[model samples]
Target: MNGNQKTEPTINRKTARELELIQFKSGYEDGTIIAQQQHMNSVLGAISFAFFLALFSAGPDAFSKPALIVSEISFSASLVSNILLFFFYKTVSGKKDLEYIWDFEQTSYAEIFKTIALFAPIIGTFSLIFHYSTLAFIFSAFIAVVGFATFLLAKNQISLRDSLLSEYRLSLLYAGRDEDYFTLKKHEFKQKPSAEELKINKYDYSICNQKKELIGVVTLHHQAVVGDIIEIADSEPLTVLRIIHNERATKLICKEYTEDTSAID
Candidate 1:
């Protein structure tokens, strides 16, 4: 049915909580890294432009045609990278809500900038090395190595997060529905609920099956018998806790009530 025919009976609450927390933490780190990179981009862009201006101020003979070409390309590429980073950051950060699903979409754009940041330097450096001295080559080489390493690491993390998200979504899709519960109106009281009875003052109910034992609190709207099974708007069978005909909704005080499954049966 509805593609959930093979859905699992239930998910382990502890495991689910841990996974959600891990994703949240990773998302936070991703945001941090993006902010850091944005600042770096601005600084790098200014430096690149300054270098370009300096080359012109040196006059035509300052560097050979080939050298000038290489330097110009490197500086321009660096400048463009900075511009792209600015736009990327602006777009992603503009959104106020940061849901888990939205993480993938945001990170994908950031990843593109990361790729450009990684390659632009390498290409620029290699080009410059041909025109400049051995020192240039050494510097470019170092930047290339670092950029490549950063790219690889970021790629791996993105892949891992994507896999985790996929698993989580699939689990959510296939999760099976268990029994639900509801409360009844106090006015409909067939017999006055004893003072010792755990009354459902709010929408929350302490449901059980046949025996009077605690199951879990289920939120619902409407009135029904305390021990009887009733179907709510969702069509799920829920055990009734306490009935309420016309009462003001009060702050929910969820005190666990004990009952056995056999009580309902």
Candidate 2:
């Protein structure tokens, strides 16, 4: 009976250890996925920011007014979407429980935002090209198609090569990492924008209620004309009462909008 009891406890211990290892493996896989997603977001954000900066630096004369405006709006949207997704991933990964991390499924909104981040820059580029010259645009389009096809062909070849490699060799390639290799290092989330980093040249809109009470401030990253109705988060739609422009920033003074507001001369 004592021998049987000893054996039973040993089995229980083994089972517990196995379960712990399974949990660890699951967490590591999830963490790896999150890490990959974060990296993708970083790349998209950088591309979007680069395009936005290029457009801004080119001033108003690089392209036709309408084309330039569309490109700027598209790139800005992409940049904002990428930034939001990066923060979403960071928030999910910051949870203490690994199970929570595994349970976290990205929403459809995230997928939509990611799609925008992926294609908005391309759209913006094409818009500018089309505005400049049809022949140049067509040539650029052809080159883009060829480049994408080549990338796919190269990727497929690499995948086929990797498939033929033995599991032992693959394992060896992944081995010899430090203890924290699978662990994701914590990232410091910046809470506030630095004084030097402030975008003073951008337009910011301030929303107020009917009583002239301040509601909130928003940066639309685009031009806001007077009498335009704009939607601010967690608030009713506001109408642009006036636009105040200065050397540093442009402010759109807004108030709660109604149908009558538009009728007013």
Candidate 3:
């Protein structure tokens, strides 16, 4: 879907079914895995900040020092990676509600990370070997920290790509994440599963209710790991937010059904 496209109240079942086929919620919560991602991101930010502090504190003396080949290479790699990030951000998801994600998604940021990771250690080793280096220990330290940060980021991206998170979709019927609406089969819902029957932790899942009647299913981000439902709403994000206030967030998301939806699958 386009970044500016209007979203549907109920997503089609196609995406949901496809995701299920791949066993989306079988093993672990995506959020659990994403926590590690956040850790690497925090470290990367720290390195950038530390490097600048070192450069500023030393001033002209820092520049008078000779630059190492690895330092030059790392700088070049950083520049290219940043440029790629700019282009990718402008292309994939431009000016949208989930724009906040663009901050973590630094575009070819993954690639930049890998480049730095691959080169930083080499540079560090070279610096230690050629200890008669032109730059001060602070400069070498900055490169070491930045390189380690990049390595961590590269590892995270390579293994965990949350393809289905924060994506715009058709509706709950087609929800792949927790907090989507499911079309209730009259026979099964007749039992009126208790709230506990519906709540599944470690992974997102929701039971749909209308006027206290079970009519559908919805997968909720009770955790809000990715973009929020508010980002995908048509009338108002509050329309959905109001759901959490009125009932359980999932209970508020109504399922699709005809008045005579009595048949069971």
What would the per-residue lDDT of candidate 3 be over residues 29-143, giving only the tens digit for each residue? Answer: 3232233334443444344334434444545544554443444344344344434434444444333523344345336866566466445534534543343554666677788
Give per-residue CA lDDT, model 1, range 1-265, as digits (tens).
Answer: 5885764443564466677777766645446545666687787777777776766764774465676677777777778888776656656663353343246535877568667765665565466565557787778778878999999999999999878866755555566411211121222338654343334332555444435444444655443455556443433465454543335432221223445688785
State in Å the error of residue 100, model 3. 16
TM-score for each candidate, following the candidate numbering:
0.38, 0.42, 0.26
Q: Whole-model Cα lDDT per candidate?
A: 0.58, 0.70, 0.43
lDDT of prediction 1: 0.58
149-189: candidate 2 lDDT, tens digit per residue: 99999999988866654453455457854333323223324
Q: Which residues of candidate 3, in runs, are more than 4 Å off? A: 1-33, 68-113, 117-265
Give lDDT for model 3.
0.43
The worst-scoring run of ten residues by lDDT in candidate 2 lies at 179-188
Alpha-carbon RMSD to native, per candidate? 16.9, 25.7, 16.8
Question: Where is the poorest 10-residue window by lDDT in model 1?
Answer: 177-186
| Candidate 1 ranges with C-alpha deviation above 4 Å | 1-25, 28-30, 61-64, 95-113, 135-265
Q: What is the lDDT of residue 248 in candidate 2?
A: 62
Question: In candidate 2, which residue pairs get closer than 3 Å at backbone N, Cα or C atoms, i.e. clash?
Answer: none
